[model samples]
Target: MIDIIQPPKAKQVLKTLSMHDDDRHDDYFWLNDKENQEVIDYLNSENDYYDAVTSKYKAFENTLFEEMKARIKEDDESVPYKFNGYWYIVKYKKGKDYPIYFRKKDTLENPDELLFDCNVMAEGHDYFKLAGLSVSPDNTMIAFGIDTVGRRNYTLQIKSLITDEIFFDAIESTTGSATWANDNKTIFYTVKDEKTLRSDKVFKHKLGSSTSADTLVFHEEDDTFGVAIYKSKSKKYLIIACYSTLTNEYYTLNADTPDGEFSVFQERVRGLEYSISHYDDQFYIVTNADGAVNFKLMKTPENTTKFNNWTEVIPHREEVLIEDVEIFKDFLVISERSNGLNHIRIKRWDGTEDYYLPFDNETYTAYTATNVEFDTKTLRYGYNSMTTPSSSIDFNMVTKQKTILKEQEVLDSNFNKDNYVSERVWAISTDGTKVPISMVYRKGIKKDGTNPVLLYAYGSYGHTIDPSFSSIRLSLLDRGFVYAIAHVRGGEYLGRMWYEGGKLLQKKNTFTDFIACSKFLIAQNYTSPDHLYALGGSAGGLLVGAVINEAPELYNGVIAAVPFVDVLTTMLDDSIPLTTGEYDEWGNPNDMTYYEYMKSYSPYDNVKKQDYPHILITTGLHDSQVQYWEPAKWVAKLRTYKTDNNNLLLKTNMKAGHGGASGRFEALREDAEEYAFLLNLENITT
Candidate 1:
């Protein structure tokens, strides 16, 4: 390893942020100015130091990268799903960095017709992402959104399938989707505010017309809410959904009448959340109405689309949380979670039969997959766990027979699910809450405190971190490492109550819960603080940052990827992405109570002059979600305050965004680098 004579110093400019009559000094606030040459130089210097520090482990990183890459099948394709007389497929060719989309008509024997080649679109761009690939109702034209810069401001364009012509008519700064009206010419899309980056406006555009000629269909005036447009599965109505963290409201437009105005299916009510799906004569509402904290199902007449006219289809259940619903002609598949594991309950539309699809593992993720056809008896779903490869299965709803359509093939022949063991364990928190942790390790690995363990979690926005299989994780498992996921409170792992208990005023519970899980593992001899490490991304990255401030002694090292560390400052500035819309999750800092509460645990605000664990902080210059400046500023602050001579590194992906690298193989290189860091720190060398 290269010896650093002296760590580079970041020039500090004293800047104090004021909130609730209190002042907090942010010495590194100037780092947020991305245009400054000094700021860019600092980031580049940090990146150079990171590379130099890890130079000795480059061979290990390469081996790790190659092994992980080898595990993945060179040429992989997704299970083709039938839509509108054509079977659509997304496949990756060997050595290609992008997916190629194709469609075949009527049967598998038909030749695949090329639709879009992302490889061609992604050329000459540092970052590229294609989203919302939608074919027109007539299947004559296609509308897709592409983001070349990583800010998520996509430029939408239309393609003529018959003429093989790409139109230059571009709609900029969209939410990366376009919902086509039944007429196949009128398209509705949502646009983000330039400053706030909130999707607040919906507009309608007719083909062959200029974007300036498009009409603004609707505008969500509420700063806390955002809007999106999509067509119902039934293809009868174009739905406009405006939502915030706590509530949702939907408006419907008759697809047949392109010129007609949309009417509200339900008016917006605070704390009232619902999503709609259409059947023959009624609209099904999956909602948390009438004190159904865990959510329930209801139905209303097509014409009388008010909450008052709704009738219960599946009433509230105290133990179950309805995560999603899939409607079919003969079945209503309810994707739910109970005991922190997913369960798909299939019920006949007539209410005659009801049963859950069987899942073998103690902790595995299973959810309803694409079932666009309203006439099918077969229900498609996906299943996987820490040890199981993902499998797509089609189950005969009537016969109760499951046929595996495709299972992910791990190219490495040495890989075997039978060689690994997974367990669902519980950890007791300081508040006596039972936190579930799913852990997996290679067979014959002893559960002793001497072994290394990587605890991962994302405990915010009610996003559950389900136990899913990863081919890349095999490298860790095979090297005497145990992988565990903490089902902490902020996630809806247990139910809505669990999420409620960990957010807003109770947000500290998330950090404490993670710490508690770590202590429990140590107390149980699963791992010790000396060998324990933590990993989280984005808000979860915030979780790692906050917990380390509170209990730095409990971890040997931790990785924070694209973290939102400067919470108080970020939340106070509504111009940042996700700030205005996230008031409900992390209460608006303008309010004194929220300001004080957030100030109490804000990671960057709480950085103290004390020893901390070895840390690896990463970010992207073009990250649209958590700005790269947050982590950059955080590392700068830590350098000034921390007393530790222990390792501290910062990696900035100049070409990537929130999600690091976009390519299939390029992403593995990042995973390899992370693993190399962990392994090198553990003194594992070959």
Candidate 2:
């Protein structure tokens, strides 16, 4: 294995940058056979080291299972009506072919008992479900989404929990997640039209009726993005969040009836980015619209015509970002994050008092209220982390008491979190942009700054990869290696302006920004050229492929999972599923301007005749977003043109879609395999 962070390479990097004057010219051909041979030998050497690391932690899985089993056994509350709980977390257990211990209740351990599970949506079709739950107010009718073959083009289906009968179904171009109206009969959801860029229309479907009974409530002519609607508790004011791709616009709407016309109630809350909550006939919104990282709440009267009712309930918060807001009785429960830690806060309606809930060490990325009635006096909420299985806890807001209610057994006891550590660092980009990077590494590794680093970035599609828990990450982080996520352009970290600045003709900004991040890592003595690996999936995979093509010498290996490598071809192919809707983001390739820009950075079009990093390109066989043949054909063409064959491998998921795997354990195994590949490429722990 090569000791990559030697003092001589830093000077070499400086000399290379100073001597290179042609910025327009591509710099992908620096890799030769000598460099390629060295990388391959290092990978072979690292395999034994990774095996030893795996052997040391094999016993940890058993410990994880025991703890989870104990947690599950302690909770004894069970009800005849299993639908009375907060989360109906139906999942495939390791020992069971059918989803077992799915309901939040104790008695209903098997999903086979649920009458609804017996009904298939279509003939010869298995209803593929994702993360969705029923409204707390009425669990009688469950509003769920079903996607055929995991295309992501879902159909919202309302099933009677009692009778197991399909009440209604509405087809959507994208995700079919919907919110139940106060009456529980109407489901409101947004849909994207295949034709126009900004033709997303919000519709309401009346249950117990045909699809023709559905009515369009709101429509957008401009490619402005609008979703995440929160129906007011009063059922009169419905806040539909509307923001343009290039600008942020917040609106509140007045609904005269359950399925009435929606008129703009409040417009342009300058600093609020559409985070609003309604409690006690009032509106509480968290907005950075005020130029602060934290958020402030705005209160508006129930009446849509009165603009004067719009007032700040909570002034600009300090030191924390309000991650989520929920109405718990007379006060508001806000989940906040500051310096990587999460806290649950309770604020009074009068805005004069505040309190904190006991969630000091509890891990929950998302939390919402459900009408789950448990015998416990406290309010029970669900919480989980990457390593920690999903568990429900009864937390008392008044007394500040918490009790564990239930724990979902998803993984074995061998999963270890102590072996991993997540750290945050800021990298200065080429254009003087400060990029936030998250690194996860093995616990025993010294910051003595010499370790293989796997860098990942997306930097497109206005997607903000929030700091969330992932159990699959343990496979890599426990192996004496480092994993980092680069927050680059086309992401919403700095808001709409940041995303717009990195997209379209400025698409090169994504590539440059990512390169700058990798350079910063090396310059700061975090890692070295030979020990650096880059990994990304989906659009992020596109970023991974482009960076490797632009700077093959920078990384030891590259992993592009379900990547959009054939950008120019996919953008031009109108027959593709999401091609038309994505024109607003990537621009129409038919246009000469977009054609020129895309050709410059599109990975599939830019294969070079030089030694390259060990590339592992992964794609789902049935992926609707990114075609599988894109990676397969790109790798084939790349191998033919490449001077040095540096392990150009493609792993296609035959059983899964874009998400890789349907089951939890299968997903973890795939993640483990990818991480193992990265470790092997970087010669980590060898």
Candidate 3:
């Protein structure tokens, strides 16, 4: 049995190491003078090739981008809500540093009325980029988070939607999640002390408050983490989710006061699962605690706490993957995956009468429910997929009437959903763990087993990277390439057990599972090794780096996006953001056991002088999630140690963070570059 330890505990020994110690292995990449120069030489060569290939399409791509921008009434526009006889919509424009834009829904098409070039909210420091936007119920205030780069700490800022006047000082913390109270006067967010990663305190920021010094109403000091807080629709209770990393213990707290320290009202149906929604005062959580890919929907009475209160509303089905759950009035809309196809169903509270809704003409790979609102006569909702853009319509419960309000990007003549086919398949892992793999390809492709395939995966930190649509992927699939997502361990695939089986020392199972999927594809005659490519970003990028190091010959090309390559270095640094907090997820690396384990797989340190695959290492200059310097240093060292002169391309986003480009066109352009790179590698002409 492998004893996997997370790296946050490595502080003591690493702190003792002198910065001047030349023999110290604190730096992820340590190369001699000759090796350093050799790596630089290799980088220069790859850069030449990358530049030459990108140059041909630069002008054409720019022209296509400008043309695409011209068709949009605004760079990007959210659905407008009619309030106080005025149509209000959140508009985002290209080239604007700030996320906010002012636009009236009625004068949407008029260029003069649209505020595109200017920032609705004045620009702040680089660290204060908008994290989220929540308009008040009355449309008077806009609540948003301004997070500092590198540091996970943030200040929740509330601006008057009417006057655009800012109110209150920023709320700072190491918490990644936050929410506004329905009253709009108070903002509820989780804050962790820099010293301990496991302990968390919930703070309520009242509008116009100057400091968080006096605003902390509740603090959980033990080894408990709190997140995913939201107010009940009736405003009578506050629902907070608290979980322990040592044991998969989760509980729901129902507090009368939004920020009050409350007792655990209901224990979460433990093991591991995602709580999707809480509607009609009943919880709708997805959990595979029972086993397999099938999940159970357990709903307890409001304010009740007990296993007896946990009633199985929807029993698990083996073949179907319940992707999402949406509550609209008296009905619950369940989005699911069956036989690689996406479907939706409406179920009543009694579960007796359920209607299978038609989800015809799905061009994208994945979709999500946008919103649900009661319109007196009917309930209105919206849904969108990767290639399909977004569509909105209203459904009437009384009359069984369905009316389409608007379809996103449908008017664009250049929009083409026919370029891609989204698919879901299962591959067994080393332990015979059934992994879900989602694939995308152009419509009408022969199973000639010659098409290039890009397999993607991310398995760590209890995060689930679900399958969804991507418009940009069409650029690759339009050629003869197949893009697939491998749902491996460290993710919530079959719920908590699946994640447990893959986390800690068992983390290697994630990489092997990905490798297994790749082999499975080749064995099934879907694609060959010569044409297979693998890609992953961030933690997913960690997956890519590990796989390439472990089985480089298995792939023709590899793309590692914003990867955490310097795992050992990060876990040792106290100043580094989220390092201390992530101790629960990754063990302390300073200990001999953890240090040895991390050294075994740390990509930057593990770069050996051996034959390697064509690799693309892309990262952002301003990425806060995985530091830009990580990939920068890793590529520098890998180029030196790798025996072959295979293309090891490094493309760093100069202005973006982990998510890459903020603008729609800029993002698509980056995607186009990525797809273009993959297509060139596969010899697939678009």
For candidate 2, write residues 156-259 as lDDT tens digits. 66667668666655565645667666666677776756543233677777766677767877776544344445556544455666664333444455544555
lDDT of 3 by residue, 1-686 (tens): 01132111111112223332223443323321214564444434445555664665566555445544454455566666543334555566666544454545345464323222325333443334455555555557766665545344455666676565678666555355555555666666666665443336666677766654546546654343444455544344566656555323333444434554555654444345445355666665665655635566777666664445677777887767676776655667777766445666777656556776566543333343344342233445655554555577766655678877777653356557765567667888788778778777777777777878889888887666656655445455655678788878887655545666676567688889999999999888789878889989888888888888898888888888889888877777755545654655666665666666766777876777887888878876556567766886677667567777566667765445777765445566666566666766765443
lDDT of 1 at 279: 91
> Which regions of candidate 1 deviate over 4 angstroms?
1-5
Per-model C-alpha lDDT, please?
A: 0.91, 0.60, 0.62
Residue lDDT tens for model 1, 560-663: 99998999999999888889999999999999999999999999989989989889999999888999999998998898898888788999998888988988
Single out the weakest 10-residue window by summed lDDT for candidate 1.
Answer: 1-10
Report the alpha-carbon TM-score of model 3 versus the true structure: 0.76
Instruction: Count backbone overlaps in model 2.
Output: 11
Cα misplacement distance, residue 93 of candidate 3 (Å): 5.3
Candidate 1, residue 347: how far the Cα is off, in Å = 1.2
For model 2, what is the alpha-carbon lDDT of residue 410? 33
- 1 or 2, which is superior by TM-score? 1
Better of 1 and 2 by lDDT: 1
